[model samples]
Target: MAGNHQQLLQLTYIRFVILFCQCCAVAFALLYLRVDLNPWATGLALLLLGLLNLITYARLHSSWPVTQPEFFTQLLADAIIYGFILYQSGGGTNPFIFMLLIPLIITVMTLNNRYIWMMAITVTAIYGSLLVYYVPVVTALSEHQHSLTSLFNFHMLGMWLNFILTVIVITYFIVRINRALQRQQQSLIEEREAKVHHQQVLALGTMAAGTAHELGTPLSTMSVILHEMRTDSTLSDEHREDIDTLQQQVQTCADKLQHMARSVAEEKDSEKTSLATELLDEIIEQWNITRPDVTYSVSIQEDLPPDLRNTTALRQAILNLLNNAADACPKNIEISLRWEPTAIWLTIRDYGAGLSVEQTNTLGQPFISTKGKGLGIGLFLTSTTLAHYDGDVKLYAAQGKGTITEVRLSRRSVHG
Candidate 1:
């Protein structure tokens, strides 16, 4: 609808230009060149065209959008007006007779195939009629005593003006149409990429759920076996310690599975909010349990917002980042938390070897990781999950010192 209105508006503006030029041409011919022509007929044609353009301009501003038929009608009116002027002047011999082609070109570009053929046939028929029915210019030229050389010169001049006008019209409108097409193509490409990304995330989620479900029975069996093994009195102290560690690892796995289930079930109702500092503290504390050996420091701003969100998805995203950082460099990691009125910001700096340009280029894509033993989907999952909250994550190299990960989340994610 908007496109139709816009095209109509463009057509109206072009008509205004054409009308102004036609009036100037008529005045120039009668006053300066003293060419004998029907003054009342030419003037009436111009006045009618001016009125049509005025109405078109007013219609463009109205609540109702311009329809294709209305646009075609306006173009047809323009052709009829131009045809009258052409018939009065010199018929097909008039240089401006080709001006009818302008409306046809506009119609072809903006309208459909049906309208295009209609306008084409209309212009063709008008040209054919003018060839046989138009008034001859010989009487007007003989009365004005124009020499043959001067007549040829005037014809050449009119043809030159027609050529310039044609170039300007075609270049301007065609370039604009080309740019609109390019923008539309770009938008479609971006939309397609987003859909593909969502499909990937969906597939990953389905696989993860299936894997967790399948592992439950084995993990339970391991837990029971380890418990019985630990009860044996003949077991050496070292062996008993190993069994205890294995049992604890199994329990952690079970806990993670349970947490995943709860997070999935409660995703829709996760409107719980917390202070920025509190959420960071909880995430860090939970992270430390899995990576007790990794050292990290935190610096949170005192003026951070209190209504920052504390969703399981957000926690998991942050945890994934921290785990990635730990895997990169186990020691001397830095975590910073801050916020503004509209957003919360978290920055994690890992004091390891900085990422290479190639590694950073593909950081957030699935199955592309900086770590040698990494599954590579952690950052991809982190990115996709944060996107749900209108959040974004960026990774930057810290001047060969380490990699810095910055996360920003909109405050609206919590307020809801």
Candidate 2:
């Protein structure tokens, strides 16, 4: 009932109309037709149902996220109240006998399959009992009922038409409303995930920047120490060689850190001049260093595509795809680029453990990953970033033994 809480409100309103209809029907029988029965008992029975509806509304208004059990209980009350009313007011002969179908129809639209069965069973059992034990409407009515035979045909026809119309209209509108509610719920979930993703990215960036600042001083100290050791003439040749290698590695690390610092300054400038080929080349070179154990290849047209205005996001998204392919099984991977006037297409195919039919269908859903210990963020973020560029990613099973991931960005995404 987290999602089905609205059922309470709907039932409350329907119950109100039901009470009004019952009271009016009873009053017409008593005043016009001079119907005979225990007026006090019947009035008391109707008042109880009205009170039940009011009590339900009051309780549900102050509370929220009504539970399924609670909803079931309230609906069960409707069945019981109507059953009691049916027994009192000439049961099977009551013109409102068909009204029992209302709760069953509402159950189908609102409740689970099991609850639908429950409503159906409850209403059917109560209605069947009415066939045996209910007072006859003709028996209860006074002798004036015998004189109005001429108008009964038209009156019964009108009532039947009214019932049909009410059932059709309510069922159609309620089903549509339920569908709209479901779509809204899905959108809300996606929006919440997006907010969480933004927070995670920001927090990760802050942490990385802080770590870089902290590591910079130690890397500088190592560079100084290694240089001094290499310069020491008293050191053995092998020791001096190791020191030189250490110094070179430290310098490389420092250069990378410096580039990281300078990237922010160069972002706007790089956007204008960095051709797509050059951008891909830079990413490949960086990936090669990170994953030297795995063999990879790249193929594309001779003429490169143009650079994007904001290149980092697209570049990072591509790298993430490459990383996913590499991680799938690090044997053989291919990156192919295709460009046309309308869009840029980049396909990465890995000759490794591929996805199944089911996995491919739900490829981009957040927190859904096939690999062990995978946080499932990389692809989610890649898809998200590409979405901002009016691009999309598609995953397919390779012809033989791997996965083929394709990315596409419209022409506007790669131009200023």
Candidate 3:
């Protein structure tokens, strides 16, 4: 709809230029060139067109939108008006008769195939009629050397001018309109991709919730068996230690499932808010508890703002990226936080084997992963979740070796 309106606006602009040039050419022919032409008929047509153009410009600002058919009617009106102008100014013999082609060229470029054919037929009919019936041009020199040779020479000059003007009109208007269409096409493609990504994320969330529910009963049975085994005095000391470790692992899994359930509920209700600095600290602390073997450094600027909407999804997104970095090189990682008035930047670097060109290109896609046994959903889910928060992730090859993950959060999304 907006595109149609914009095209209408462009039409108005083209009409204004054509009208101005037509009036100027007519004035020059009458006063300077001493061409004998009927001013009353041509003057009335130009005046009406100018007044109509003003009304059209005013109508564009109203609540009503310009439909495609209405636009076609406008171009049709232009062809008819130019037809009248040509009839009074010597029709096909007039040097400016080629002005009729303006409306036709503009229509072909901006309108649909149906309108293009309509404009083509209208302009062709008008020009053909003028060839058979039109006012004969009479100049002051017509009584002198106005022989057939002189008239032919004059027509050849007019043809040259016509060619130049046609080239200018096509180059100026058609090229710009084509570029705008390409940009619009690209925007639509991006929108469709985003819609598909959201649908995929929704499906994954539903499946994860169902899987978490199914794991609960088995985890409970394992917990009960582990307790019974712990109390058995017949077990060796070394075996007891192993049982304790296995019990802790099962308990960790149970706790995570419970946390996932709570996070799901909370996300549905409303996301909780926290200070920006404190939220970053909490996410890092949580990641550290899960991946205790990885060591990381943190540096946050002191000029950071206070309140930030920290959803569970956002926390998990950061955690997923951190885990990706840790898996790359668990022994050494660098984390930093910086902020501007309208954005927050978080950078995480790891001293691991850097990504290959193919991996870098397809990193966030589903089933594409850097780790040998990675599920590949982690980065994709992280990227999809961050989009809801008005944030995005970028990865680059670090100075020597490893990948640098940069997460950018919009200040408006964080504060609100």
lDDT of each: 0.85, 0.77, 0.84
TM-score for all predictions? Answer: 0.77, 0.55, 0.89
Instruction: Put down candidate 2 lDDT per residue, 330-388, tens digits, no spaces.
Output: 77688888788888788999988889988887777667887888876678779877887
List clashing residue pairs in candidate 2: none
Worst ten in a row by lDDT for model 1: 136-145
Q: Compare the candidates by lDDT and give the number of the best one.
A: 1
Worst 10 residues of 2 by lDDT: 137-146
Question: Candidate 2: lDDT of 310?
Answer: 45
Greater TM-score among 1 and 2 belongs to: 1
- Report the lDDT of model 3 for residue 372: 83
Instruction: For candidate 3, write residues 1-416 as lDDT tens digits.
Output: 55667767777777777777778777866776567888898899999888878888898999897787887888788889989988988888877788888888877777889999989999999999999888877877853445677767766876687668667766777777677777777889999999888888888888898999999999999999999999999999999999999999999999999988888888856677888888898998999898999988888887745567878888899999999899889976999988888888899999899888888899888877788899789999999888888888999998889999999888788555
lDDT of prediction 1: 0.85
Decoy 1 TM-score against native: 0.77
**Backbone clash numbers for all candidates listed:** 0, 0, 0
